[model samples]
Target: MRLRSCLAALALVLLGGAAHAAEECPAKSTSMDDIIAVLNAAPGCDRAMKLFEACEYGASGDVQFGEIVEKKCEADFLGHLKPPQKLSYQRELRVCDRKYRNKSGTIYISFTAFCRAEVAQRYSRRALKAGGAGR
Candidate 1:
């Protein structure tokens, strides 16, 4: 009888703690301007660094490309972009390469850095409408 009562009290305490923890968690609020600012203000290398950092933060470690993305590839994309690169939006058709880890077909990875002006233009327009990015 005493053990059952103690267990019930512990369950209630844990449930209450979980509810409090959830309520204390901060909300996620990111704007297009924040993204653009990080991308625009920085030079090629700097921009890539920030992008890699952001991708790392967003990616689950379990993802095959996540670590490589955070450490190596982000700068490569910046290298390919034109000077004074800014985010804009429009739609453009593109293809992506699906890469794999090793000779073994079991672990697969995909890394694609295919963003066209059209997509950027479209995104820019939508971001502007959404009051995210300003002209």
Candidate 2:
């Protein structure tokens, strides 16, 4: 429940920079794959959200797990960007959370998941296009 709300808030905040990403590489109609599984064996988003919420609120010793997922997300997202665009995307990624400025720990964690889903879907759609570039 908490993670769900946090994710919603995170999306509104992330919309600012993610909006740029959307403008740069909009998602297309295609088979979407979830990419927030930096954990590889994360099962699904519901479990992942539970992990994030537990990690954030200290209900479990999952802080290290969350950090690893976060780093992986950044790394994976960076892989999709061209050299010239990388800097701008990174800036947008960083600026997203800061601009919205939410105090809830759940918000931050859910934002990570939301952004991951967007990035994954964007890349998936791009791959589905004629030449691996979004239409």
Off by over 4 Å in 2: 1-80, 120-124, 127-135
- The alpha-carbon lDDT assigned to residue 102 of candidate 2 equals 61
On residues 30-58, what C-alpha lDDT tens digit does candidate 1 reach at each position?
Answer: 44334444434444432333353453223
- Please report, in order, the local distance difference test score of every candidate based on alpha carbons: 0.36, 0.45
Off by over 4 Å in 1: 1-29, 55-96, 100-135
Question: Per-residue alpha-carbon lDDT of model 2 for 1-135, expressed as tens digits?
Answer: 999999999999898776555321112221122222333454433343333443333322233444444453444344566777667555655664464356566556545544543443343344345244322
Estimated TM-score for each candidate: 0.23, 0.34
What's the distance in Å from true for residue 70, model 2? 7.1
